[model samples]
Target: MADITHRRVRTNGIWMHIAEKGDGPLALLIHGFPEIWSTWKHQIHRLAEHGYRVVAPDMRGYGDSDCPADPASYTILHLVGDLVGLIDALGQDQAYVVGHDWGAEVAWHLCLLRPDKVKALVNLSVPYRPRSPQSKPVEYMAEKFGDGFYITQFQEPGRAEKSFAKYDCLTVLKKFLLVNGPDLLAAPRGIEIIDFLETPDSWPSWTTEEELQYKAEKFRSSGFTGALNYYRAMDRNWELLGPWQGAKITVPTKLITGDKDVGFQSFGTKSYIESEFLKGLVPGLQVLVIDGHHFIQQERAELVSAEILSFFGKRSGN
Candidate 1:
């Protein structure tokens, strides 16, 4: 963090704040739900030292980036448009894009929507989800997982914002990052999300209290409304992205995910990833199933960086 410089760059219709270092070919790191650019602290340092300019942004709705008042502003088209503007703002024709969780969703779209801007991709956790022409995202999510699902619970706007605001940001960060194993995601009536923070889960050796404070402070100031808007706008994204239906991500790519990650363990997600689904979409693709949870980059920083370096070496000849 000491060496990394922070600055705000105007992109799309918002101002995106980015943490950047190094001076070689660009490596743009996109963070996910409830996470800030700080989540990629290790990657920023490692990738920079390895001779590449690494830029990790607050990403529109998170951290120091500008957050629009409407949830509708958080669509994938908006997110991808920001990335294109970010690469352009940095004076680059293309970049090696990497994303985790929700960031992975954006990365996939970036490749599909504007493959010319991305040289290659290394995504973690969440896999590419083919659009469902049968129904809107919210409709099927409600039918299959019910309103109790985290994504569905986020649909009602202020309800989840109030629930998350019940506890301090540090506690919320701890509960979210340190949650052990994959469990069914649900927030039943009368139960606040902060309830998960009450117990002392086994401490993770990778993160320090000081680091957690940095992330907590960002969320505390920005509030959770902007982050929750990602889910709130999914249905709208589905409608807006219909033009690219049946499109495949033709970029050279590698995907890594923890066995215990919530996205990996989601019903049929593992099967789809392991089967022809992923390869059919990502023609030049590699997959690595590592041992860990959702926050695999931080929990296994050295290993994750090694994987990224190795993928760049093999895939893009970096």
Candidate 2:
């Protein structure tokens, strides 16, 4: 493994911490909620060895990155701004971007809003979704999945934080990362989402105790408010992104996900991915489904690394 280095850079009016290794054409790795830059441990080293500089950041509101107090600050515009600034700070005009979960959503918006900043995108977990002109995202989610849905439940400020405070950070991390199945995250009316999530019987085989502890410690220090703010800003993002309705991400892209991912299983995503509809939204799209769960990057680290390298190799001429 190459020596990984850590540093902070000023971007979009805040200091963002990043973990990076190797050196070549830039490969920016973005992690989702309940995780930090270390989430890409497997890919960073692998890509670096194959002549790519891999930079993974602990996105705003997670890990050592600055956590803005206002939920309003967590909008997709803010996220894309941070990433755009990050690319500039690194002295690169564009980068190969990879994202998972919330990070994937951000990556999609990054490519949509500013195609010039991304060389190519390899997004896992979440797929590209066009802005809906009919209704706000939170309202649609509430009507479709009800208020008990995790995103709907996360709307209220401090509510999910209070529920999460009931347990230690490690336990909170375990519940979010380890649990599986489609629609399994929905809480019953009057129940907290944290309590509703079934705890895993054992630790996942892919990650080590040290890694989980490092993440747990970061969450313990930062609190979950910054991360939860991403959910709270869903409606706000919908309102702001109205001008971009029906926009297609023209960047060359690939989506690799676990066959059993909750996002893949629920909300008619499987059908949508299989349908011609997705190709229309992401015209440069390529899809691959693997036998794993939501945390496919870590759960199937070697395979994920190889797949990313292969896709990037073709584009980067490595």
Candidate 3:
């Protein structure tokens, strides 16, 4: 076991609980929606052993962090600013950043908006989707692919949050962690697994019962509202990025996704992601495909950690 310490720092008017280990070459890890600092448990010890300072924070609304009632506070710009504030609070000028899901979206924006604060970036699952200058989100999706069911569902005001809040929120979150196809045939309840069923390749190796219980307990610690606020900020984030629409990120960047990640096939974004998003990157950029689902860090922690360590090692040396 690594020497781990839990601490809190004030950022963006809220206190964020962060877990830190090791002491050289700072590597800041950010977890996505429905997850807390514990999500990076596997990577924290391993990365620290490899001579990197690992800092994982309960991003604003989850875990022991302060949960702001205002939905607007969860916007991408605010999230990015929160991370910048975190770095300042830590007294570091810049650090290599790694994020998954919503965290990845914020990491990408952080690199673009505060390039001086990010030495390198590793984003899992979600790829960089550049906003167009005069394109309405609906029109943009229609031009690239039709419907965009996920975004549409998320943009449906309070529908998703309310539904999940009413239903078994923990179960819904567990279904997403399934890297393979839905176990619908075995599950007692016949609820259809959405993202996991659609993109089986993105699923990571199955987590142990202990691990699953740990994550489930965390979700129960705080109701779904804080996590769901991330979804509620879609339009707000869109408006926030209006000024930086079409701006390319010029930094050391790497995008990692599961081969069966539903996000790639999501609304025909695979082609657009490869052709447009990846191509728009101005500096060092690379895409990696791993055998896992959206939560690759939790499922395939060794592989994810190795890839990130290699990327940061080479970049830091240069």
Candidate 4:
């Protein structure tokens, strides 16, 4: 951890802050909402020790990275462009990419839009869903799960931010991070999501008070608007990425998710992952379902790091 260095690199019209260590091949780690580069601290140390450079960036809106004010700026193109520019800025033509949650969504598009830039991929939580040509993402989410659905509720610019502001940053983080199941995510019709989500009396053994405070402090300083803007740009992404509809992610890939992860449990994702559907889209794709929740990398750090090492090491022939 002491060898890890932090700096900002200019890429895709913005400066991105990253935490990095080691010096072999690049292993780009992209984080999801409400988190920072430190989320991969465990992986960084382990992967570096195993002979690969691991760079985890706070994607676009979170941590010390630049936060563009326009929701339109957070589209899939912008997100993928950021990573493409990042790979170039890092002096690498290709990388072994790993992402979690929103980061996984971005990684999927990165692989789709520019497979040349990704040597291989190991994404967590979110699986690749082929674009639906018939409906925009936000509208589709509304039709399928109604407005109270978290993603649907996140559509309105300031709605979720206001709901989140009701609690202190620490409590707000706790509400999201400590959630144990998918069923607890959606609010009951008119209820605000942050208000609906319960805060646990005790913290999980995998995470510490220090880590939570660090994440809370970053969110408090940056505010949630930029991060929530990713959700706000869902429809825009659907519009802008129309050309990529039904595109296959040809890169060798692995999808590792917790059995209890909200993304895996909700929206018929389990069936999607289990069926031939996912394999049809990601050819040669491997899926690993483990015990834990959405933040599986952090919760099961050793297993996650080992899986990553195994997958990428094989790709690199190390």
- TM-scores, each model vs. reference: 0.95, 0.97, 0.84, 0.97
lDDT of 2 at 178: 83
lDDT per residue, candidate 3, 30-81, as tens digits?
9986677877888788778777788999897888888886778888877887
Q: lDDT (CA) for every model shown? A: 0.86, 0.89, 0.73, 0.89
Clashes of each: 0, 0, 9, 0
Mark the regions of model 3 whose C-alpha exceeds 4 Å error after superposition: 136-151, 155-158, 182-205, 314-318
Off by over 4 Å in 1: 189-202, 314-318
Task: Kindly provide the TM-score of model 4 when superposed on the true structure, using C-alpha atoms.
Answer: 0.97
Model 3 global lDDT (CA atoms, 0 to 1): 0.73
Model 2: lowest-lDDT 10 consecutive positions:
309-318
lDDT of 4 at 21: 93
1 against 4, candidate with superior lDDT: 4
lDDT of 4 by residue, 24-121 (tens): 99999999977889889899988888888889998898889999889999999999999999999999999999999899999999999999999989
Over 4 Å off, model 4: 314-318
